[model samples]
Target: MSVLLVLPIVLPLLAAALAIIAYNHRTLQRIVAVGALIAVVADSVFLLLAVERDGVQSVQMGGWPAPLGITLVVDMFSALMLVISMVTVLSVLIYAIGQPGVDQDQPVFHPVYLVMTAGVALSFTTGDLFNLFVAYEITLAASYVLITLGGRREQIRSGMTYIIINLLASTLFVVGIAWVYAATGTVNMADLAVKIAQLPSGTQTALSMFLLVVFGIKAAIFPLFFWLPDSYPTARMPVTAVFAGLLTKVGVYSIIRTQTLLFPQHRPSTILLVCAGLTMVIGVLGAIAQNDMKRILSFHIVSQIGYMILGLGLFSVAGVAGTVFFIFHQIPVKTALFLATGLVEQSTGSTALSKVGGMIRRTPLVAALFLLAALSLAGIPPLSGFVGKLGIIQAGLSAGEYAIIGVSLVVSLLTLFSMIKIWNGVFLGTAEDPTLRLAASEGETRLATPLLMRGATVALVGVTLAIALFAGTLFDLSERAAQGLLDPSAYIEKVLG
Candidate 1:
């Protein structure tokens, strides 16, 4: 079982090397990339089952002991993250394979994509602070390549900003790690749990606030989030989709993991609640102000992140459960939405809402996919988004967090408004562009929406629907995972043993 924990991280790294070796053989590259992710997905499912049935799974690399070696562990939360992240990554790769320009001529895409997958797996499985930092560097370094893959002027411009901001966050993260390691004499997360609590109140408080800022920037929460909308909208659609789906969520996962493990609190923190509220309001407000599909969706990523953080902010079982379930809802839907928007872009040669219209006629299947995903994003009933939001709102109400709850409701409605704006502007409005009036196959050489792309999107939406249908079971798992976070004695014992 411990060896099972290493499989997810190792498989992708090995396949990435294979992909690089097959660089000139594009078919082999595709196989290596897709097959590697598929294997990861299967392994992750087994890992999740193993964790749920057994307990936290831990492994010390190179036959070394805990606190002195790289320890990788997975509880329910990290296991859930692994499963969903792999699905989203694999689905997007399929979409990219079908799209003509995405990875068609480029051999570097597959290897780099696999490297990013390995990095994400490492982030989920790492059991220590320094390894977490190393995992982040791995993920972000790959993202730097992915974001600027085409080397377009806009991509370089946006990627530079993205790179610079992430570098700042990385630097702060190092300082935070150094401070904690210096105080505790070890970076092992479970060990730090014991040592950090022994620190003086003032030191703990300072460390808590400092690391929150570091992760807040990485998670794109509130004022720290300005870089995301600017950075994501210019990338290739698959690149943007993967980034929107996985990267910020990794930061949010880190916040939940570290804050709960290293800086346990008995009650909700007002500072976190304030950040959550403002992140929601400001993000949706930014969404409403955007006319481009990519930019609008990008802002919503920041906004949706607030909901997850809000649940964590409550620092209660229900709240954390809500956060977990909302995260489950978010990963698939965000990826699906971006992919759908990509399809929309393919149909009309633009994601500008003002320029492209009447997609309902041009690409009926795509319009349906987009509408279903958009409705889910807006929290329409019985969809995964609604179930996720319901859990969060219900938990908040239970906690008597009335103000942020009100803000969340308002933000939900505003989210609907922006989705409607995209709906009306891109789907229902007149076909202002002649390109929008014709499918790529009909006459438009610059536009395309292949079946494989649509199939991949539909598969992700199915995952979203599956989440909605199985909401009760997932909520139970989330509660269990939350309980583990609130009481990590077992995790600590297992890691240190």
Candidate 2:
């Protein structure tokens, strides 16, 4: 079981090495990347089951003791995250492989993508703050390459903004780590959970604030998300989907972990609630104002983040559980939407709402997929999004957080409106204008989307539906994860005993 925890992180690095060795052989690179992700998904599933059945799991590296040696730990939360992330990565890799020009333009894509997966895996499993920061750097470095793969002027410009912002976040993370270590005398999360409670109230609050700002920026919370709308929509489809699906969630996961484990006694719930409200309102409004599919989705990323943060801010069992379930729900829905839009872009040569229309007539499958995902994202009933939001709203109501509850409900409505805007602009109306018809015809005739791309996206759509169908079981797991987070004594014991 302990060994299984390392495989998710290690196998990807190994696959990356193999990919680099076989750089000239695209088929081999594809096989290696896909194989590695398959293995990671399997390992993550096993880890989730093992943790659920047994308990929290931990292993010390180099045979060193806890608080002194490097440590890896897995509870329901981390294991679930690992599973979803690996699954999403695999799906996106398939989508990328099927794209006509991806391999031709980016020979090193497989290796770098695998490295990024390794980084995300490492971040989820690492039991220390320093390693978490290291993991962020690893992921961010690969993202810098992936984001600017074609080196187009727009991509380079957006990548530069991404780089500068993330670099600042990284610096703050290091500073936060230093402060944590100085205040708590150890950087191990489990040990810090124990020691942090011993610190003076002022020091604890101050450290929590520092960490919050660092993660807030990473998570693209309100007022800190200026770079996301510009950066995400400029990247290629696969890159954008993966980033939307995974990257910001990592920051949200860290916030949940740290707030629950190290600072449970000193939660800054009020401030988080305020941020949550603002992030929700601001993000959705930005989405409503966007003219392009990718940019609208990008802004919604910021808005949807508010729901997760709302769960965290509520700081209760139901709230955290709702957040956990929401994370799982959002991952696939968002990724599928991105891939669906990618399909639209491939089929019509444009994601601009004004230029693309009548996609439902040309490619009903893509339009249907996008509609399902968009509806799910808008919190329609019987979908994972509705379930997650209902849980959070229920939790919020119980907690007397009426303000954020109002904000969240309004955001959901606005989210639906934005989705409708896209549906109307890109899928609904006629494209009878000669020039637009000619461009659509050329796009369909010359750049037809590959079956594999659609297949990968459909697979993600299936996952979202599965989440909805299995909502009871997944929500139970999330509740258990929230319980573990709310009371970290067992986790601390498992790591330190």
CA lDDT, every model vs. true structure: 0.90, 0.92
For this target, which candidate reaches the highest TM-score against the unseen true structure? 2
Which digits, one per residue and each the tens of the lDDT, describe model 1 over residues 1-497?
Answer: 77688888898999999988887899998988888899899999999999899988899988699989989989999989999999999999999998888898778899999999999999998998999999999899999999999899999998999999999999999999999988999999999999999899889988988888999998999879999999999989999999999999999999899899998743337888998999999999999999899999999999999999999988889989999988988998999999999988876778888788877876788888888888898999889889889888998999899999999999999999999999999888776766555554477655557878889999998999898899898889899999999888888998999
Summed backbone clashes in each candidate are 0, 0
Q: What's the residue-level lDDT of 58 in candidate 2?
A: 92
TM-score of 1: 0.97
How many backbone overlaps does candidate 2 show?
0
Give model 2's TM-score versus the native structure.
Answer: 0.98
After superposing candidate 2 on the true structure, give the runs of residues whose Cα lies further than 4 Å from its correct spot: 442-444
Clashing pairs in 1: none
TM-score list, all predictions = 0.97, 0.98
Best candidate according to lDDT:
2
